[model samples]
Target: MPVPSAPGGAAGPATPPAPHITRRGLALAGLATAQFMVVLDSSIVNVALPSIRRGLDLTPAQLSWVVDGYLVAFAGLLLLGGRLADVFGRRAVLLGGLTAFAAASALCALAPNGPVLVGARIAQGAAGAVMAPAALSIVMTLFPDGPDRARALGVWGGVSGAGGIAGVLLGGVLSQTLGWPWIFVINVPVALAVGAVVLVSVRPFPAAGGSFDIAGAVTVTLAMAGLALGVVMGSDAGWTAPVTPAALVLGLAALAAFVALERRAARPLVPLRVLARPRLAVANTIMLLLGATAAGLFYFLPQYQQNVLGMSPLTTSLTQLPIALTITAGGLLAPRVAAVLGVRLALTTALAWLAVGLAWLARADPHARFLDGLLGPFLLIGAGLGTAFVYVTTLAVAGSAPGETGLVSGLVNTARQMGGAVGLAALVALATATGTPAGTGTPAGHQPNLTAAFLGAAALAATALLLSLTSALHHPAPTAASPLLPGQRTST
Candidate 1:
C-alpha cells in the first residue's frame, strides 16, 4: 500500500510520466471522455432494444444477448485488462482498446443481423474492459493525491453517472429519429476523437515487466465470465433452469481454482496480499453493495415510468434529468465533504442518504405523482450515488502502490460490474415473486412489484452504509500535502 510522495508518483520501467505530461488538462479531458464513452455504451442500447428486435428480426433470447453480451465480456475481462496494462504499458493498452472499440462500434452500426450485432457488442465490451482501467490509471498518474486528485475523480464520477442517464435519452432520440444504427455510429467518431486527444496529451508510462501468469488469468477470467453469465441466465430463464445452476457452480469452481493457483504462482494475475489488505477489502465490499443498489435503481426506475405511469421513452428520459444533474452536483461536492469528514465518513454519509432515498421510493404507487413521489427521492439517490462513486474510488485508488493503479482500478470496477449483474437478477426475482398472484401466472398488464425491488435496493445501500462504518475504513483527516490525502502514506 505504499505510494509515492510527489506528482506522477511512480513509473514501471519507462521514463517517469509526470515530467512528460505537459498537457495535464488535455490529458484529463481525454481520460474522462474515454471513461464517459465506456459508461455511455453500457446503457445506450437499452432504449433501442425494441427497435433492434424489429430491425433484425431477433428472438427474445437474441435480443437479450445484445445487452448481456456486452456486460458479460466487460465484466469478465476487466481484471485481465488491468493486468495487461500493468505488464504491457497503460498507454499502449489504452490506445489499442480505443482502436478496437471504434472498429467494433463501426461493425455494430453496419451489422446485417442479430448475431453480427451481438458479436460486435461483445467485441465492444472486451475493448471497453481494456480501455476503462488504463484510462483510470492514467488519471491517477496525472494528478497526485490530495485536492487535485479528488477534484479530478469528481469530474470523472460526474461524467460516469451522467453518461448512464444521457445514454437513455440519446438512445430514445436517435433510435426513433435516425435508426438504431446511429447509436453505435456516434461512438465511432467519439472513440476516435478521444483516442486522438489522448495520443497527443498523455505520456507513456513504463510497464511493470514480468512473466504473465497464464494459468491464473485463464481461471479468473473464466470465473468472472461464468458468474456473470449465470446471473444473466437466471434473470432471463429463471434460477431453476439447469444452465443457471450449472454456470454458477462452474464459476464457483473456477474461482476456487484461481485462488488456489494464485497462492502458489510466482507471478500471479492478482496478488493475494493486495486483496487481503483490510482497507482494500472493506472498500471493495462496500463498493459492491453500493453498485448493486445503484444498478437496480437505474434498471427498474425507467420501467416504472414507462410501464406503470405510461410515460413515453423521451418523457421518461426528461423526467430523469434531475437525477443526472443532482448526481453531477453531488460528485463535484464530494471532495469538499471528504476534505472535511475524511473518505470513510463521507462515503458512509452518502450510502445512508441513498438508503433513505430508496426506502422512500419503495412507497411509490401507480397513482403517485412525479414531483411528489419520484423527484424527491431521485434527488437524494442521485446525490448519494455521485458522492459515493467519488469517495469509494478515491479510497481504493489512494493507497495503491506505485505502478499498480491499473490492478486496483480493475478490482473496484469488477466489483461494481459483478454486483450489477447479481443485483439485477435478484431484484427481478424478488419483484416477480412479490407481484405474482398465488397459483396464477402473471397476466399481461400486471407488472412486477417494483416497490419491493426498490426496498431491496434500499437494503443493499443500508448494508453498505453499515460496512463503511467498519474500523478498517477509518483514516486521518485531509490537508494540503497530507499523505492521507494521496501521497506516501496509506489513506486506509
Candidate 2:
C-alpha cells in the first residue's frame, strides 16, 4: 500500500486506516458491478426471446430488433459517451447514466408493445454507452498502473466475461420462474444499488479541458450506428437486401467524413495522432478479433447445445457455468502471465490458446456428451478470453495521458462492440451458406451449421494470433506503467 506524503520533508504516515481501504474496495466493487450490469443486459434477453415474443406479440423481425436495437445504439454512442465523461466529469456522467439506465429498464419491463420494448431497449443501450466508459474511467482513476491495476482489472475482466454467460443462465431461470419482464426488472435494482455505492465511495474526477466536438461526435455515431444497422439487417434480410446496402454505404461515408473532420477539428473527440500510436492500434485490432470470437461463440454455443447436442435450455445453461468460471480464473491469471512473458508475448499466447480452443470446438462430435467433447474446449476458450481481455486492455490504456484515459477506454470498448456486432453477422452468414448439406434437412428444421461457425471463429482467432506475432517483430513490447513481476524484463 502507498502511504500519504508528509509536508516539508517530514516522514510519511505509516499506513492508512481501515475505512480508507474499505472505501477503495467499495469503489472498485461498485464500478465492476456497473460494468457487469451493462454487459449482462447485452445477452440477458437471448434466452427469453420466445417468452418476450409471446408476451409482446412480436413479428420475427421485431423480435430480432429487441436484441439488435440495444447493440446498435450501444456500439454507436460509446465514443460520444466517453468524450462526455471527459468533458463533464466521471462521477456526474456515471450517475446520470445509471439513472437513465434504471429508468429505461423500468420502461422495458412495463412496455406494452413490441415497438415500445424495442425503443426502451435502445434507450437502455444509449444509457449503457455512457455508463460503461465512465465506470471504467473511475476504475482507472482508483488504481494506478502496476500490480494493483492489473489485479483490479482481473476482477473487472472476470466479471465482464462472466456476465455474457450469466445472462443466459439468469434469463432462463427468471423467464421460466417469474416472467420475461423479470429480466429487465432485475437490472433496475442492480443499477440503483450500484449508483448508490458509487455515489458514496467514488470521489469525483475533474472534467478534461476542451470544448465538445459536436460535429465529430455526430459523424462517428452515425458511422457506427449505420454500420451496426447494416450488419444486423444483412444477417436478417440477406446481404442483397436494399436497406443493407444503403446502410453500409452511409456508414462508410460517415466514417470517411468523421476521419476528415477529426483531422481538422480544433477540439476533436478522438485525436487521430493518439489513435495512430502503434501499441494502442495493435491492441484495439487484436481486441476486435477477440471480441468477434467471443460474441460469435456465445451466440452459437447455446443453439448448438439445444439443436445438436439435445440439451434442455436449463441444462445448457448449467453446462456453460464452467466456461464462465474458467474465464474469470483466466483473468485472475493474466497479471502473473504478463509478469513472466511481457504484454506482447502474453497477448500472442492468449490468442494462440483461443485459436486452439476454437479449432477443437470446430470438430466436436454432435453425438458426444458435454464432458466428452464440449467441456475441454470451453475451458480452453474461457481461459484464453480471460487472459487476452486483460493483456489487450492493458496495452490500450498503458501509455495514455491522464486526461485521455476516458477516450482510450471508449476506443477499446467501441472496438469490441463493433467487432461483436459485425463479426457475429459475418459468422452467421458463413454458417448459413455452408452449415447445411445440399438437399438435406436436420431435425431442428434447418439449423445453421454451428460447427462451421466455430471453424470461422477459430480462423478469426488464428488471424489475431498471426497479427500479434507480426506486431512483435516490428515493435518492442510497450513498457509504460505496465505490470511486470519483480526483476522481469519488459521485452522478451
lDDT string for model 1 (144-205, tens) is 76778788877886677768767868877888789989999999899899989988987777
- C-alpha TM-score for every candidate: 0.80, 0.81
Clash pairs (backbone) in predicted model 1? none
Which residues of candidate 2, in runs, are more than 4 Å off? 1-32, 46-67, 110-116, 138-168, 196-210, 397-409, 433-446, 472-477, 480-491
The residue ranges of model 1 lying beyond 4 angstroms of the native Cα positions read 1-32, 46-68, 89-91, 107-118, 136-165, 196-209, 235-240, 340-342, 395-409, 432-449, 475-492
- Backbone clash count, each prediction separately: 0, 0
User: Which ten residues in a row are the worst by lDDT in model 2?
Assistant: 1-10
The CA lDDT at 236 in model 1 is 59
User: How high a TM-score does candidate 2 get?
Assistant: 0.81
In angstroms, give how far residue 24 of model 1 lies from its true place: 7.0
Candidate 2 lDDT, 1-492, residue by residue in tens:
000000110111122223223488888899889888887887677667656766777644465567666766676677667667768887899999999999999999999999999999989988988888777766655666677778887788667766766886897788778898999999999999999998888766667656777788678767866776686667567789899999899989999999999999987767899889887788788878877787778767766776678776567667877777777678667777777887678888888888999999889888968888888888888888878876776767665664554466567767776677667666766676555643576653345678889999999999888878765323434345433333333346
lDDT of 2 at 330: 80
